[model samples]
Target chain A: MTGFGHNSEDEAEGRIEALAEMMARLPGLGPRSARRAVLHMLQRRDLLMTPLADAMHDVAAAARECVQCGNLSTAETCAICREERRANGEICVVEDVASLWAMERAGAFRGRYHVLGGLLSALDNVGPDDLRIPRLRGRIADEGVREVILALPATVDGQTTAHYVADAVEGSATVSTLAQGVPVGGELDYLDDGTIGAALRARRSL
Target chain B: MTGFGHNSEDEAEGRIEALAEMMARLPGLGPRSARRAVLHMLQRRDLLMTPLADAMHDVAAAARECVQCGNLSTAETCAICREERRANGEICVVEDVASLWAMERAGAFRGRYHVLGGLLSALDNVGPDDLRIPRLRGRIADEGVREVILALPATVDGQTTAHYVADAVEGSATVSTLAQGVPVGGELDYLDDGTIGAALRARRSL
Candidate 1:
């Protein structure tokens, strides 16, 4: 298998190239960077590459969606969804688990979350039923949810999903959207016109 | 584990965080991008994450350094070193396997390679015996090598290593270094002083 210069060499190279190609599919990595990453991993197999492979395999085997909120979890329900105190009659709805994680990272939302998995997109033919809207309405009544805060993006599809969710849970809970305006530490010059206008319109008396 | 939010929940989160931390150790990924990549992978476990994990495991299990040249291979010797036709009395000496790969990608060199693993560095206290210089000397005599082209970088350490290698293989084979100047498509304005000087000194007549 070694010094004979047969097709086994191509097979070995193929394994490495296949790994690089798979790595390139990740969010921030491209073909060249993926190759470099693969090479770096190969150079530090004991220290980095083997450990990375184990971690990925562990996550792949364990990770699942929270049955209640659609968040990534190892169990049927996620940590936040299972916490008794988190059921504070408020459910913050987000377009995906990433946004849900962002809210958790901020540590501002003590209430539970409801991950929609995606927004309603007319362009992509995504409808209300396509998301977790039906499940959200079920949670509002079953969990005694009083407020459903939409922590969705400011995109058209996001707003459309929010509106649809609001309508779906019309009589059950109070529906609200995340504040739209200039961000914290944001410069006025760098802000777009829509943001500036929203900031001006939603001005506080302070 | 499904509904009880005890230590198991934290353990679940730990698995994900651990995966993200490992991903962050990659060349181009940071903490945030690593988290995002993890989330993306979790979402498409069967489609992307599982395949990635399998590929990484395969590479980790099979990948090994070639005994002859230090290039990556599954066998004792690399494909180039094993190919009889590639033993054309020319050995392209490189600093690492990555440089060897870059040269392979260019497909301009038709001979075997000798990977030095690293260059001579005074600051790091790396000396001749620290690299593959002695092994290279052995190859030059044993393999009937005629030319040893140093395709190392233009860094100070790279040049230092090249000079050391040239002296080491002085009487055994013809030694040469890669030409320095403005890159093929590069403008003179972007080239450094040393490169311009080298280009002027090594100017060839039509």
Candidate 2:
């Protein structure tokens, strides 16, 4: 954390360095790249920096996981689940909040979402209890949910979790999954609008 | 901004729309790839989001332009100019702060920097007064600067500005420039450390 090359005592260093440290930890950024990014943001403060900071502050203060579905929300339940228009006897299940957001971006699904938080990873010691399996079961009974659409990753853990969830909801509700031709190891969030649309339209029985 | 189709409150809409809007505005990101990046970031928020958000916030508050040199600084003068060791009778001149930082990252120069903010653009009606030209002349006389390095972009505007600065500092200091073959339209920030090093080593009379 202290190894970021340049150091200065300008009153801004503390805040800038803190930001750089956090950015350096991101997937594609290093100490050098983070420094560059920080500098760029400072240069464009009015158009980019201020708005971005406000958004971060708002989200940091208000963002909370939906109690029922694990999606990000300002309220206990995400807006998706709260909307009566979305509860057409269907639920689209995804592995993470990002995926749920992606499904929403496509604007094709008129259903609520159930965020699993993560897949059941045996290698990582994750299991059904570790995920939202119990809550999903509870929802099936409580909401009279007709269909459960699995929009998980194509990785082994994701597929395994999908199948496991399918088995759990076997007798209780109709279980389906976004179709293949989705790239292997790909998350639903990476798919294009067309591809996501195709997968959703061509969803088959699980 | 609102037309980008981002309705953060609407859980019924998909994330692709939100991603497209955000991506279109990024420096190197586009709408087509924004969706992919958003998905990638969400999939590994532990690996990406938390860090990215932190970086965004830190930079948002700390980054400010050096009042003296236009370099990204948390202070009045950038770290390079403030260091007594770097004030060793030399000032490397560059078009922008990004270039100056790029030089620092290479760790080759042992001198201070003078950022001109931008090149002279005739079509855009930019003039010598618009840049730090007068400041460079004043620094030479005030700081007893003996050598002036011109690490300018290879564009028409950049070359014009370099020559103009050279004329102004001709009698006061030994003027030089980074050798050609550094690539036209390529920013110093994008150059490899080795290339930058070689360019610095082989710098010629301007």
Candidate 3:
């Protein structure tokens, strides 16, 4: 008996391995899960793998950031930005497109959105210029936006970004943030100290 | 404020949403994680997304099962089957290419491998003919195989397939299975009853 041949790694196994490696780099996948995903895809080449590859290629080639608001788009403006009625004198600011999609999924906010691309991170050397902060300020005045809703995360960087944007657009529009409190359907005991405190402070009469 | 535009699901957002839906179907990923994966890819289009798409496409087009051993291959025979020295009268039979890759990673067994693709499952209606049992039998005699190692799982279906193959190649070659014992670095306290029982039953003198 002999070990795996030298060419074994450079053959078909190698191609599959390379694909798995790329998959492992994905946000929610690790080495074991990536291998499983690759094998699953290979097993259903016609049904799943081929379609997924084609979908990825299509998105990669066509998808672009919305030039106006930083949302994903195939053209200069995103679908939301292109919608006439979404321009309801309001713009919701978010850290990234994921947040914008989340807001859309909720179907609660009817106004347009502005994707910040990222928060102001001093440690990583990410500054206001790195994100779409300047464009957001421009849209406020140009679109006659009366209100700016900050739907950013509750992290320090998120707060820093919200304050900075609020100051930048001061007097231009009324700036507010998503309310901080225990999530709906959340238990009081499970809530963090900060959340419980915020919820108590912002308590309203029923 | 109005609900999302009727055409919101038909534009650029629709494309990204479709891609996310497809990605969510992959193993180990759900809706939220899939969205994160897509967003992460989109953020680094040049660094990750395009290359991953290209890799998947290449694998989809080229990958094929080895005609002789059932291992993944780009050509008629897998790298293992094409290697001359691997035909050393020993053949390790495994359930799928993942198992074959696992064996290769361990580098313990030096002989060639045979992939069964799946186990005999009465519920799933999988049988010997559905798998590569016939090929294993033919290889035993044709390759002058001395030992046929069954590297199958310990599940009922796995054992059934192992017994079926062992019976099929009884006279042609010697059949054996891997030792069942406490895994390396495993705690006996955390082991399941079946594993502990198997370990005790197969215990040997030090």
Q: Please provide TM-scores, in order, for all candidate models, with all chains considered together.
A: 0.91, 0.75, 0.90
- Cα error of candidate 2 at position A163, Å: 1.7
lDDT of 1 by residue, B9-121 (tens): 45666788888999999999999999999988887889998898888878887778777888887666767787899999999999997798789888999999999989899
Clashing pairs in 1: none
Using lDDT, give the best candidate's number.
3
lDDT of 2 by residue, B143-195 (tens): 88999999998778888998999998999999999776577687999888876
Q: What tens-digit string does per-residue lDDT give for candidate 3 at B1-206? A: 12333334346667788999999989899999999999999878888998998898888877787878998876657778887889999999999988998998898988999999899999999978899988888888888899999999998999999999999999899999998889999998899999999999998899
Which regions of candidate 1 fall more than 4 Å away from where they truly are? A1-9, B1-9, B187-197, B200-206
lDDT of 3 by residue, A56-99 (tens): 88998778777788888766578888889999998999988889
Candidate 3: residue A154 Cα off by (Å): 1.6
How well docked is model 3, in DockQ terms?
A: 0.40
Higher-scoring candidate on DockQ, 1 or 2: 1
**Candidate 3 displacement at residue B45 in angstroms:** 2.3
Interface RMSD of candidate number 3: 6.3
Superposition error at B27 for model 2 (Å): 3.0
DockQ of each: 0.50, 0.22, 0.40
lDDT of 2 by residue, A5-117 (tens): 45456454466667767656544556876666666677677777666545444444444566778876655566777778887889899988768767877898998889888
Q: In candidate 3 chain A, where is summed lDDT lowest over 10 consecutive residues?
A: A1-10
The collision pairs in model 3 are none
TM-score of 1: 0.91
